[model samples]
Target chain A: MRNRKMAALTTVPYVIWMALFVVIPLVLIVVYAFTSKAGGFTLQNFSAMGDYAKVFARSLWLALAATVICLIIGYPVAYALSKMGPSFQRTAIMLLMLPMWINFLLRTYAWMSLLENTGLINTFFDNIGLFDLINKIALSLASDPSAYQPIDHFQMINTQGAVILGMVYNYLPFMIMPIYSVIVKIDRSMIEAAQDLGADSVTVFRKVIFPLSLPGVLSGITMVFVPSVSTFILSKLLGGGMNMLLGDLIELQFMGGAYNPYVGSAISLVMMIIVMICMTVMNRFGDGEDQAVML
Target chain B: MSEKLINLENIHKDYGGKVVLDNINLYVRDKEFVTLLGPSGCGKTTTLRIIGGFETPSAGVVYFDGKKINDLPPHKRPVNTVFQRYALFTHMNVYDNIAFGLRIAKVSENVIKDRVTNMLKLINLPDYAKREVSSLSGGEQQRIAIARALVNHPRVLLLDEPLGALDLKLRKEMQRELKSIQQQVGITFVYVTHDQEEALTMSDTIVVMNKGKIQQIGTPVDIYNEPKNAFVADFIGESNILDGVMHKDRLVSFCGKNFDCLDSGFEKDETVDVVVRPEDFEIVPIEDAQLVGTVKSTIFMGVHNEIMVETEDFTWKVHSIYNAEVGDKIGLFLTPDDIHIMHKS
Candidate 1:
């Protein structure tokens, strides 16, 4: 009885913390999603959810695109690193992962120097003479000069395209690491087995490696997509107000221009639900047994 | 006799300035079972990998059925490997595992089905076609690996310790199974293993390797009875080596006995080592004894007793079915056939 009481006492803080920080917020979000500011309880939040059609579509597109790019660029680098001798692999991965140790926002700020108006790219463009100031100014002029007039000041600084670039840069290593560990763990003999069976490298990769790397790929995708869907800082800093992704809209209602607590809670609730749904879909394709077998 | 199927000429492998395989020349005759026997780090697996096209020779050529396959990738090679882990395609069922190669070669669905079914029967796992590979036991998985590799119909099958993962009983069972399978498939089988018994029991030709070099290559009988050097003799079976000096053309003195052996061509009074098998000596009466020693201990080993005889010159063990009490004075009889002279390293 004493041991049980001690165990309960030790767990008391965590239980209370979970109830206070997790359960209450979740319950509040669900409650806010159903109720509205004007009345008691209704599907007003669901009705207002339609108001985010453009944001939803654009956010989904950019998130998916970033995730895809992450996988494409990260998988090979990870595989290459894994193939190196153990000592070399250890140092190389350490170097590759060093950038991740710093603050994520600082890295984003560094990319700002690269993508900023009259930044490195613009300076190159100035020398080349094909483009103008900020990444946004060049973008607005190229896409639609009439609706999107190029601002004299830091234009294109905050835009959907810039957000995607940030997302890709940020999530690429995450995509690579999981995929790399899996790829490295995959028995080299399986690839040989495939080939001895008369499979060219392409066929072996397709039939053996790609299918085996599915768990890592799916999880990598989930890692990138889920985070990108919720990420607002990049969109806020890089997307020049012409585009408003779901993250930006959530930021607006929660902490910025619009102080709509009900809408903010509703968006958070929806984002969590969507993330759960995506994870479930990924896990369904990534059968637990096959995933265990892959590594 | 089947023609030579695969030939490796002066193959050498160096990794980062460290030589893993040094000037390895070998040949695999058609439908023959060749085993590369070596201790760990002796480059046996590396040699097998070179044949499988998983690794390239630093300075040599591999000819598969008279075609130079030095630059060919593993998939393009006319060889499949039953990896030590039996690297079965876990994502695929046993049927798909067998059919993977056929599908890769663009065989029709109907043909693939037939071939896979036939292979499943060959490995004696027809009903297991639908079972996921991870669900299978170690022995079953090993058969699946063989089935998967064999279904491709390659000219050579490389088995790198395929039964190494199995228990001792299964290892013995699989050795027989592997030999029969090789005979049935009629493709050259290149197996790699550290176990002398497995190689001695299964292979037609055993290539003994040590320190990344081929020490000796011969038939199992040749390897065991007449090992070329100390390493080979010691590695193949239990051997008692005694330092002795040649007294005459056919006689050598060791363990306080002047034994007549067929071995000759040693300089008069030259120092040499004599290899004696424990089972070769027999217990005899004291009057007819060729060598005398006091029994130190008697170890009962089910069918036979291992008696350790301590003598003035050397300690020797003799296995006999006759009961001998511990610490008894025994006269050991060594026939001319038991004592073979070996080169001291």
Candidate 2:
């Protein structure tokens, strides 16, 4: 007990850092959301709920879409990784995380380059006689004189697909980490128990594995969904400002179009509330006594 | 009563570079209780798991009745195992855990209830039907495990140290309950345990194994009284094995003295271990005895006195009603029938 007290005293620096960096910032955000620059203490900041309503709806939907995509792509990969040997698991996860180590903007630019009209994909097709085939057949009526149109014909440079692609790529490891840890810790004997009870492979997965991995699913959803909602760079770089995503509008408020701290803080507060509500709903479904026991 | 229910033929198991079960073969007669008894890592559990279809033998075949079950999965087999930890589904209540097999068999809800109720009564746990298995006691969990296995009416029951985690008193109590349950079910039981006393008490036929090979398979009486070698003799019970040689019919020479033994098969001058139960030795007057010794020590047991006597060549242990103090001179007499002579294999 005395030693524990000494250890508690030793954590003073970390406790102060957490209060200053984390708690104070969150409290300040909530305080600033209601206080407006006009009356200084009016709910006028929330009065124009109409202006930010579209942003809230769009960002919430996009985050949900990205989380769903991550679930679809990440779950099977995590399950496959969990069944491998230790060396294979380590190397495979390292390779999956290799993209994250590169600069995030650089990787986003790489995707932009690939999807662009005059990018490597288009150049390869021109070199491979695709353009010649069109010209000879006179299907070239629609073809332009330029061999390649850089970001002119392809709309990928400023699209929602670009945002989703960026989100899935950036947040894939988050989806995998929780799910992989949970799946790997699943007892072999529980699956064996299901099998010995005459459940076939598909039935076993439906009855045992899926329901058992709900905690990881909920955690991964929170991890990917919360971050993707407010991401501005992906929409700015890939969407090319053509589709004004919620994140782009929020960035515009802080960076260029209007220096309205109150509106931006209100949007941020609403996003935080939506993420918390989703988390609470998830917790309600899988709280105290509902979890599947692997043992 | 079983008509050769399960048969295993020359099964081999290798893990990485080391072999765990080597060329194993055995058979389970219908309704007969057989125990695989051995020290740790002797491959008894491996053989049980193979029969349970949790493992495929590297070589040789496993047969259930007459059908080859070499490639069959565990769920496809007509066998159920009571694991050491019971391995009861903690997610379920007692009723659900028992009803799992029936549910998998796709029995109707009414039939599932009836079958689970019957099992609960059989295991003397009728009141525990709605209780979460995690809330049950160790002994209760054990009974629930037995009930779960029995509800399926499997052709054979595989028990891997079912009483291993219980306390001494509970373990002994469960041993009796398990034996009675086997008799009531009348199913072939293949039990695996390293506990010698559990094997001696519960098993009708015990297969003793060592170093991945079967040492001997025999009735408890045969295994105890007529052990095949030194390993079986030492493993089964108290064996006072003296290095001796058979000299002639019903006679052996040990401790630099010729004494009568209970062996007849060996030729004269064959090396053998002379085993005698402590109770078999009688202390007589030194004048008319075949062997004489001075009392080395005396231990007071409730029923009998354990006296150790030091002879000229060896120290002899005996359980006697007579009390003799240390340094007292006495004669040790053994009848030909009391001495058990086993060959050194």
Candidate 3:
């Protein structure tokens, strides 16, 4: 009885913290999502999302691309990390996470400098003679005589590719950490058992390791997808306001020149519903139900 | 046996610097249930792994079916292993787990199903095909593990302490069932364990090991009765080892009493270690006995009374039907066959 009382007492601070930070803010968002400025219930805010459908479509597509790219780059890195010695694994993980210690906005701003029209990448390409090849290709593809002007540098900045690069760079560590943890926790005996039963290295991986790591892969997908789908800073700075995402549209309603909190709340609510649906679909596709509940 | 099915030639294994197996040579005949019995970290599992091709020996070669196969990976070898913890794939159900090897072999779907059904029946889990591996009991999991390995019909099956996780009753039941399964399948089995009783109960031949070396390799009776060293005598069963002197052939003296033993050829007054099993000692009267001692402790085992008898120089364990109280005098007699003599180390 005394232990129960002590436990209940210890939970008081956490309960208060959750109510103040999580519950109240969520209630306020819901109230604003469904109510007008005169404190009257209305569905106009929800109908407002139809106007920004292109932004939502573009954001989802870009986020999907970023997620796929992260999985492609992160799976091998996580597998290699799991195979390293303990001290080496620790150092590798620390290095992977070192960039996140700085301000996220500052890091996103740093990409703007590197991906600009006259940026470091174009300068490096110019040194490697890739700029000359690109110029010759453009000249050959031109139709008119005057249109055969040589290209000076590639227009890589403010493109969808630039926004995706930012998202992959910022969210890749999220992908690697979970997959690495799951791979490391896989029992060594399972691999040996597979081999002992006449499974070669490739068969063992296809039959044992890959299937076992799906839970981590699912979690990594969600981790990278959710944030990339809802990000505003990367699309604004790296995309240079040319490619407005759902987050950018929502930010415009509440904090930008639009200044409408009701529409912002409605978009936030819709994004939450979309993310929840995506997660459910992913969990159904993979055998991540056991781990999905945990997350 | 016509020829050794598996022969390990001068197998030496070293981990970083410390040697786990040193100059080990062993041979397993076809259809033999051989056990590698030793304490933990005594290289028994290492020997099993080397045969399974999980670990490469630092030196020497392994032969399977009279051909050198030292460099063959485990997947290419004609052997399967039932790991210590069962190592069942958690994501797979029992049916898929059993069918994994058949699928890898590219067996037809119909044949895979038939073999899996037979294996499930063989392990006595007909209705557990669709159940997840994690839901099964320890004994059920162990049976599935055995079934998974046996389904491949490998030439040899290696089991590394497969029953170490079970309760006593389940372990005994599994032991009998595993022995019968091995006999039924006619596959050579190389089992590693530290349990002496388990080794004696199931193995056709027992290889007693200690500190990276084989102490003795013999049948259960020979290992128990005619141990080659004190280590084997102490490890195999309860023994009352004592210091004695060999006067000449058929004559030995210990506890200030001369005893008649089986034929022995040694220098005069050569020191030897004598092993006498506790159950071998007869509770004779003091007048007709060769040696006598005072009882120190008595324990009531289920079938016999375990009494410790202390002489002036050594303490002896005597297991007899007759109970002797503490501090009581008891006389013990030994026959010539009961005395096993070895050079003192």
Candidate 4:
């Protein structure tokens, strides 16, 4: 009884902190989403979201592509880390986390400098005469040298690919960490058992390792997908104001000439719902008490 | 003589400059059940792994069915292992787990189905085809592991402490079941364990090992009746080991008394280690016994009473059906055959 009383007393501060910081802001957002600028309740904010359908679709597509690319790259890296010696595993994990320690904006800006038309990547490509080879191919196809003028450098920045590159660079560690944690928790005996039962390396991975690591894969997908879908900073800097995501549109609503908190709140509410739905679906894959026990 | 199923010649294993197995040579005949018995870190598991093709010896040769198999990987070798922890695939059902190797072998669908069904029935889990491995009990999982390995039909099966996780009663039950299964399958089994009783209960031949070396290799009766050294005698069962002098052939002197023993060919008055089993000592009247002492403590084991008698030179353990209280003067008697003498090691 005394322990219970102490536990309840200790939780009072946290309850107050959450109510003031989290619950109040959420309540305010919901109220503003349903209220008009003139202080009257209305549903116009939701109806207005239809005007930005293209932005929403583009954001989802880019996020999906970035997520797929991260998984392709991160899974192999995580599996390799899981198989490395303990001393090397620790050092490699530390190196993976090193990029996350820098400020997010700084990392994206570094990508920007490297990806600009005359930047390091394009300069190296120009030095290798890759642009000249493409120009030569275009000339052969067009039958006119004047029609296919060779460029000095390739344009990589101010494009959808640049934004994706930024997101994959910044959020890849989040994907790898969870997957690596799950992979490392797998028992070594299972691998030996598979081999002893006549499974070759490829068969063991496909039949044993891949299936067992699905929960971590799901968690990584959700972590990278949700954040990339909602981000506006990378799109603004690397996308060069040409491509606007839902986050950029929401920010524009509250800060532009048409300063409307109601529409901003509505967009925020919709994004939060999408993230919640995503998490719910992913959680279903990792459900049941047995999965936790196995982990 | 039956054909040799597996032969390990001069196996030496080292990990990072530390020797785990040293100069080990062992042979398993066809359809024989051989057990490597030792305490932990005794390199029994290493020897078993070497035979299983999971661990290549630093310097040695392994022959499987008269073919050199040291260069073969575990997946290529015709051997299966039941791991100590049962290592069942958590993501798979019992049927799928048992069918894993068959699927890898690309067996026909109907044959895979028939084999898996038969394996489930053999393991006594006929209705557990769809049951996930996580839901099964330890014993059930163990049976599934055994079935999974046996379904592969390897010529030799290696088990590394497969019953080390079970409780006492369950372990005993599995030991009997395993022996019967070995006989029914008629395949060679190479079992490794630190439990001496389990080794003796299930093994046709027991290889006692310690400190990366084979201490003794014999049948259960021979191992128990005549251990090769002090370590073997003490490790197998309870013993009252004492320093003695071989007065002459067939005679030893200890505790200021000379007793006739069955061993001979020792130099006169040479120091030796003498082993007397607790059950070999018969309690008698103090005046008519070979040695008399006061009982220090008496423990009532279910089948026998264990009395610790402290004589002038050493404490002796005697097991008898009769109960004796603490502090009571007791006399112990031993025959010539009960005395086992060995050169001090």
Candidate 5:
């Protein structure tokens, strides 16, 4: 009885913290989502969500693209890192995590200057006559020669690709760390067994290494997709406010020209539901063993 | 006798200048159950891995069916391995795990299904095709691991301490089962183990190794009865090795007494090592004994009592069914055949 009492007492602080900061805020959001400005229950907030459907579509597709790119780039890196010697692995992993030590906004802001029209990348391209060569090809391809205009610089910033680049840059470590740790923990004997049973390198990867790394991939997707979908600052800075995402729209309802907490809460609630559904679907694909490593 | 299916010539392995195998030369005949027996870090596993193509020897050549296969990868080699830890794919079911190699080889699904079903039956887990790999017991998993490798139809099957993880009773049962499986499969088995009893029980030929060098290779009975040196004599079983000198042909002198032995070919009055197994000493009356001592300690070891007797120059270990109390005088008698002589190393 005393042990049970002590355990309960130890949990009291966490319980109080959860109730105060998490549970109460969620309850307030749900309440606000279903109420009007005058405090009467109404569905008007949800009914107005159709106007932001394009924003929702843009956010989902962009986040999905960013996540796929991260997987394509991160899986090979993690696999390679897992095969390195212990000291080299430590140094490589530290380098992968070094960028994350800086503030997230600071990192995204660094990408903005590098991707501008007169940024370092475009300046180097111009110095090499890359824009002039592209213009020459464009002039030859066009039917009317006068319609082709020579460009001085490439417009890399203020686009959806730039926002994705920012998101991928900021969230890449999240994807690689989990996958690297998981691959490193895999038993060396398992790969040897696969090879001894007449599996080549590709087949061993397809049948053993890749399937065993699914939990890490799922967690990486969750880690990268969640923030990329709801991130507002990336769209605002790199996209120059043109690619307004769901997060930006939600931000606008309460803090922008439209000061309506009701609609903001409703959008937040809907995004939460969608993210929860995506997570539930993903967990079905992962075997329950390595799922705890996500947190 | 069958043809040699695998051969290792002048095999040497080292890890960054630290030698693991030293000038090793061994061969295995077709359908022979050969075992590499040694303690841990004795290069037995390294030799096995070299045969399986997992590790290339630092300086040597490996031949499979009279062909030099030193550069061949493991997948291309006609060999399979049952790892120490089973190494089952957790994401796969039993059926898929067994059919992994077949699918990799692009075998048809119908044939894969048939082979997997047959393998499951052979391993005595006929209804376990759909069960998850994580849900099986250790011995069941070990059997599945064997079945998984055997389904590939390799000419040589390598086992690296496959029964090292089981309990005592289960290990004994698996040993018999493994021997039966080797006979049933009729393929060359290169098994590695450290347990002397396991080596004796399952292997047709046992290769004893120590310190990256081959100590002795022979049949189990020969290894036990005629160990080449004091190391093999002590490693195979309990031994009372005494430093002595050979008096003449078939005669040895130890404990200030001359005893008749079956070994010869030693120079007159040359120093030698004499090995006598604990079980070979017969307890008799003090007057009828060749040597006598007081019992220092006694241990009941399941079927027999092991007693330590302290004599004038050496303490002898004797295994007998009769009980001997500590501090009591006892007598030990040895026949000519029980005395083994070896040149001093």
Candidate 6:
């Protein structure tokens, strides 16, 4: 009885903290989502959400593309890192986490300068006569060479691809860390057992290694997808305020030209619900197995 | 006699200047249950792995069915292994774990179901087809590991201390079960274990090893009754080894007394080691005692009393059904056949 009381006492601070920061904010958001600017109950905020449908679609699509690309690039790197010697693995993991120590905004700003029209990449391309080579090929293929305008610098920044590249560059280490930790902890005898039972390398991987690493893959997808979907700064800085996402639209309602907290609260609630639904569906794939559900 | 199925010729294994196995030559016959018995770090498991194609000998060739299989990978070898910890795939059900090899070989689903069902029945877990691997107990997982390897019908089955993780009662039960399973399948089995009792209970041929060298290889009775040296005698069971001198054809001198023994092929006054099992001593009256001493300690060991007799030169361990109080005078007698003489190693 004394131990139980002590445990309950220890949890009081955390409970108070949650109530102050989390519960009250969630309650206030729900209240604002259902009320108008004049403090009267109304559903006008939700009815007005139809105007930002394209923003929602663009946010979800870019996040999904970035997540898929991260998985494609991260899985093999994690697998290779897991196979290295212990000292090498320690060094490699340190290198992977080194970039995360820098400020997130600073990293994204670095990408901004690198991807500008007169950036280092475009300068290098110009120095190598890459633009001339491309124009020559276009001239050779065109039926009307005079109508074709000569190409100058590649339009890399201020595009959806640049925003995705920023997200992927920032979040890839998150994907690889969990997968590498999981793969490194797998028992060595399991692979030996598979081979002893007449499984070749590919068959052993398909049957044993990949299935056991599903929980890690699921967690990696979550870590990369959640922040990418709700990010406004990357799209603003890299996409140059043109391809606005759901986060930017929500920010505009509260702090931009439109200053209505009711519509902002409604969009925030909808995005949270959609993300929760996506997570629920993803966790269904890991139903009977052991999974690390971060939420 | 059955034909020789596996031959390890002049095998030597070293790991970065440290020798793990030294000049080992062994062979296993078809349908014979062979055990490599030793303590930890004695290279018994390394020998078994070499035969299973998990390790390649540093200097020798491995022959499987009269063909050199030194370079063959484990997947191409017609052998399967039950690992020490059972290593079951936790993501798979019992049915899927057992059917893994068959599926890898691309056997049809109908045939795989039949074989898997038969293997489950053989391992006495017939209704556990849908049970997860994590839900099974240690013994149940051990049986499933065996069933998984056996479902492929490999020519040889290698077991590396498969029962080392179980309790005493469960290990005993699994020992008999593994023996019967090996007999029923009629496949060559190469088992590695450090437990002398388990090796004696299951193996048809026991290869006693120590310090990366084979001490002796024989039947269980021969290994127990006629150990090659003092190390073998002490390792297999409780025995009192003493330094002695072989004075003549049938006489040995130890504890400042000469005794008649059954062994005779030693030179005159040649120094030797003598072994006498603790249970071979009989409690006799002090008047008719060949050797007499005062009892130092007595322990009740369920089936017998273990008494320590402190003589003038040596403290002897003797097992007898009769009990004696500590510090009491006692006598011990031994027959001529009970005194085993061995060369000093």
Candidate rank order under lDDT: 6, 5, 3, 4, 1, 2
Q: Interface RMSD of the predictions, in order shown?
A: 1.3, 1.6, 0.5, 0.7, 0.8, 0.7
Report the lDDT of model 5 for residue A134. Answer: 92
User: TM-score, each model?
Assistant: 0.89, 0.89, 0.97, 0.96, 0.97, 0.98
Clashes of 3: 0
Per-candidate DockQ versus the true complex? 0.71, 0.45, 0.89, 0.84, 0.85, 0.83
Q: In model 4, what lDDT does residue B185 have?
A: 89
Candidate with the greatest TM-score versus the true structure: 6
Poorest lDDT segment (10 consecutive residues) of candidate 5 chain B: B1-10
For every candidate, what share of the true interface contacts is present? 0.93, 0.38, 0.88, 0.88, 0.93, 0.90
Quote the positional error of residue B84 for candidate 1 in Å.
Answer: 0.9
lDDT of 4 by residue, A1-88 (tens): 9999998999999999999999999999999999988899999999998998899898999899999999999999999999999999
The local lDDT score (0 to 100) that residue A82 gets in candidate 1 is 72
In angstroms, how far off is A112's CA in candidate 5? 1.8
Top DockQ model: 3
Q: Model 5: what is its DockQ? A: 0.85
Task: Tell me the TM-score that candidate 4 gets on chain A alone.
Answer: 0.93
After superposing candidate 5, which stretches have Cα over 4 Å from the reference? A136-147, A292-295
Pairs clashing in candidate 4?
Answer: none
Compose the digit string of candidate 1's lDDT tens values, residues A104-129: 98988888887788677766666765
**Can you tell me which runs of candidate 3 are displaced by over 4 Å?**
A127-129, A136-145, A285-295
Model 6: per-residue Cα lDDT over A1-295, one tens digit each: 9999999999999999999999999999999999998899999999999988999999999999999999999999999999999999999999999999999999988988888999988888999999999999999999999999988789999999999999999999988988888888889999999988888899888888998888889889998999999998999999999999988998999899988899999999999998998899779987855676574
Q: What would the per-residue lDDT of candidate 6 be over residues B116-188, giving only the tens digit for each residue?
A: 9999999999999999999999999999999999999999999999999999999999999999999999998
Minimum summed lDDT over a 10-residue window in model 5 chain A is located at A286-295
Between candidates 4 and 6, which one is better according to TM-score? 6
lDDT of 1 at B233: 82
Clashing pairs in 5: none
Each candidate's number of clashing pairs is: 9, 2, 0, 0, 0, 0
Q: Write candidate 3's Cα lDDT for A95-179 as tens digits.
A: 9999999999999878887877788887888889997897777777778747577756778789999999999999999999988
